[model samples]
Every structure is written in C-alpha cells, then in structure tokens.
Target chain A: MKNLKIDETKYTPEMTFDPETLVIAIKGKSYPENTEEFYKPAFEWLEKNLSDLGKKGLTVNLELIYFNSSSSKALMNFFDMLEESVDNGDNITVNWMYEEDNESILEYGEEFLEDIETLPFNLVPLKSRE
Target chain B: MTDCIFELKNDLNKNGIFFCFSGPISQDLIVEIGDTLKNKMRLEDASKSSMRLVFSIIIEQAQNIIYYSEEKVRPWSAGVNAGSISVGIITVAKKDNSYIITSGNMIKTEHVDKLKEKIEKIKGMGKDELKQYYKSQRKKDPDEDSKGAGLGLIDIARKVSKPLEYNFSSIDETVSFFTVTTVVAEGL
Candidate 1:
C-alpha cells in the first residue's frame, strides 16, 4: 500500500504512515472541530494495513503539543485499535513524546500509558524547545 | 450606542477581562482564540504548563458551546450552503494571580437539569477521583445525544485549580442561558 501523509493544519496534527518502514508518526497540535471526521481516514488506513504486518513490527509515534478533549477521546480510540491488533498477535509498539517542561502533556501521556496493556507504550520526553 | 463603547471597555478592564468575544463561534475562531491567548500569555512570561491548562479549558468550554448551544444562525450572506454557527460568549481574565475563563451559551431548558447534575457531580470530585472518572469515561462511548466525547467537562474539571462553577438562567419556557467558569493559577 502507498504511504499516507496528511499535512498539519492550525487545528490538526501532521500524520504520516509509512508501510515499508512500518513507522507511523503523528505530530503537532490536534483540536479539529470534527474529531471523528478528521481521524476517519487514518483509522480506515490502519484497519486495512495493520492485518498484513510483517515481522519488522509497527512503530507509532505520537508527539502532540496540545489536543482538546474530543481529540483526547479519539487518541484513546486509536490506541484501543492498536491494543486490539497487539492482542491478535500483531507486533506493535507506541512511543508517546512530550516536551520535558510540559507536565500537562506528560501527565496525559502517563494516563494513556496506564490504560494500555500488552502494548509497548513509552513516554519519551524531548528537551524543552528553545 | 457609540458612546457606550468606552464604558463597555472600562467595565471589562475593571473586571480583569483582557480578551472577550461574543456571538457566532466556529472551529476557525477557536484556533485563532487559542493561538492569540498563547501569544498573549507568553508575553507575560507565563509558564508553559499554565498556558496549556488555560488553553485547554478554553477549548473545552468553547467546544461545548459549539456542540450543544441552542442559539445558532447561518450566515445567510455567506451562502445557502454555509453551515450554521453556534452563538455564545467567551472571556479570559486575570485576577488574583489566576486566569479565569468564562463561557456562556444558550441551551434547551430540558438539558438544564442533566447538565447541572453532571457538573455538580464533577465539582464534588477530588483530583484523584477526577482523574479516575476521566479515564473511565474516556473508555465509554459518548451518550446518544452528545455530539462530542462526553469527557469534555471531566477533562476541564481535572485541569481546574478549583471545582467548576456553573449557573443557569431561564430565558423562557423553552431555553436557558448556561455559563461555566474555570480558574487556573498562573504559577501552578
């Protein structure tokens, strides 16, 4: 399958999925008005591609500066999907990146980490942006 | 009317309100408000975390208005296909070393009791309780009538430095005006 790329908007995150390397990166702020609509395409793509995963496994990186509550729910749903895939014996790991000084983001990452089971979810903190 | 503008400005300033917007609210407007507030707070040397909390509260409150406000109007001049926009008021203020966010919207009278009960329960929750509640609610599907995840209020409750404050005023037999306030300490 071809790679999926969505450029970031003022209120949406940049999302890119690479099939060859098995790395999916979602970065930036996400507070789209229609959270479900905004994430529908990515969900569809993952549904179609996750079942055909190779031994290399899939790496998902989520680096969000800020996201509203609805977007938070969407992220939860996204992670739930990944957890389901992991349960089905598909190799999947998630990296949740946040800035060191932004405790709110870190706390959010930690909450998600707590909810997730069986998925390798890591909270990677980047140094404060200059 | 023109002369009252100065009095209005003074009133807002006296109340510590630095930013205020009333009327139609849309997604694009939320982006602009969030960015502008971030920039304004940054200039004041507010910490990154505090700014994030303030911004998140505003987003949640404004979104609630966008989703459930009973007052709406289509910008007829924009075109027939133009979508209707929710009407509400949002304001950000600085007082006692805390940032105060207030949002007001019109809601159907039938929703008042349910909304009040929800906020009341959330207001009674402690920090740890709020966190647990948020996590549990996040896992569930939104209520049938909810347009967004039903977790917005709980999320707001978790970030706030104090319990959420809310009020409802009957506008008529069919509708009421609802307002909610969230406060975040600047240094926290």
Candidate 2:
C-alpha cells in the first residue's frame, strides 16, 4: 500500500490519502473543468489499495470551502465507493467537517451521514474563519 | 390612465427594496453582498441558521449562473468569466404569518431537467436518507464536475417546504433561460 497527495491550488483542494492509516482527506474548493478527469485516478488508486480489504479499516475526512454542482456528483460517487468498501469488510468511518457558522455545510454533512448507514460516520464541527 | 399607475403605487406602500443587482456574478460580488445581507439579517433579527441558508442559496445560485449559464458572453475581463448571473432577493414579512425571501435568476436551459429531477428526489428523502445520499455523492464523485451533478439544488431543496420550481424562457435561437426559487417558513 502507498500514500497519495494532491496539493491544493486556488481552484482545487488538498487531498491526502494514506494506505497505512487508511485515512483519506479532501479539503478545499472544487470547480475543476473536468472533475471526472481528476477523480478517476484517485478512485482507481483506492480500488487497487482496497482489493484485499478484508482486514483493513478506512477513515475519510471531507472538508470543503465550496464546490460546484459538477463536483457534487463526484462526491456522491466517492461516498458510494466508501459504502462498497465497508461492505467488503473494510471498517470505514467518514468524518464530515464543516464550519460552525456555515449551517448549510453542516446540514450538508448531516445529509451525507444519512445516506450510508452501513458504515461509521461522524459529523464534526470546525470553526468558521474569514 | 396615468392615474392607474399612480394608484398602483399608492395602494402598494412599498418597503423600497433595499438592494437588488442582477447579471453575471463573481466571488467578490458574492462576498460584498454577503456583507450587506448579513448586516440586514442582523438588523431584522433573522436567526443565524436561517440567514446562513439564504446566504448559501445566493452563493449556489450565483455560482450556478457564473459557471453554467448557456447564454454566456465573452467576459468583460479577459480570462475572468461572466455568465447569465443575477443576484436579487426580496424579503417581505406579510400579515399572513409568512416571511418570504423570494429570489430567482436566469440559468442555462440544458441544465434544467436533471436539476428538477434531483430536487424532486431530495424533497422525497427523509432527513437521514438525505444525508446519506449527500455523502454517497461526495464519496462517489468527489470531483463532481458535471454541469448536471446538481448537489447544490439538492442541498437547497432539503431546506425548502416543497420541491423546487423552475422555468425556462426561450431567449433566442441558441439559448434558453432558467430561474429557481426556494421558500422557507418562519418557524420550520
């Protein structure tokens, strides 16, 4: 297993996933012209990394400043993958973090938590900053 | 008669719309309006949570127009963009026990149907299920860049009392326009 890191940019977020910790983190804005183009590789990496997940545990930290509708579809696919991984005996925990004053983002975290009941999910609060 | 128009004004004692601006938007514009609206909300005693919803809707809708409006024109500033963006919200507290903050803007026609479908699906979802769906989408296509992924409307619909309503008006041979509105109750 290996680790992958996609550094942040003005329009993109910081993504860091470690196979050893089974932790995946995506934080920042997402309005990429080709979302699938960017995420396809990440998904593929996860697929290969989790092939023998019978004894592995995974945790993902999701935080965002903002994302376009296009990015939203990609996010759904990411969650579905996590659900599949959990089903495949990979203990999965998703920690959705949102700013304290950003009620919409908080509710967003809550909404995602509702979709997947098969895995462990946490809706955590982060301080709002300008 | 001229009296009819005058009478219309007399009968409709207005609040003098505090602020209204329309057409292609930008992040700077959003931030500026956010400041103004936040001040207004504070003055009106609107709950922090409610204000956040309204603010988020503005960002979502404005960004939608900036990035997806089909009637796009070459931006005024090179490299920067200006789509069919508009930002206008009016809040009227009626005697009928309803506080309405109605806002709408033009959108691309091609992006409408799937948006409607996604809103409907969200309206039918229970709270817990809505969260799960949101998460699933997050995990599945974390880089959701499709013009139609439409998580923005889904998130907004989850706040409204009913499904989202939209309209597409034929603007010309090449493009159609769109508008979306969301209504939140006073004490929901």
Best by TM-score: 1
Q: Positional deviation of B126 in candidate 2, in angstroms? A: 10
Candidate 2 lDDT over residue span A3-78, tens digit each: 8899986556899988777778999877554466778778888778865542576678899866655666777677
- How much lDDT does candidate 2 score? 0.63
Off by over 4 Å in 1: none
The alpha-carbon RMSD values of the candidates against the true structure, listed in the order shown, are 1.1, 6.7
For model 2 chain B, where is the 10-residue window of minimal lDDT?
Answer: B89-98
DockQ of each: 0.84, 0.28
Fnat per candidate? 0.79, 0.48
TM-scores, all candidates, are: 0.97, 0.61
Q: lDDT tens string, model 1, A1-130? A: 9889999999899999999889999999998888999999999998888877624599999999999888999999999998898888889889999888888889999999999988889999899895
Error of model 1, residue A51, in angstroms: 1.3
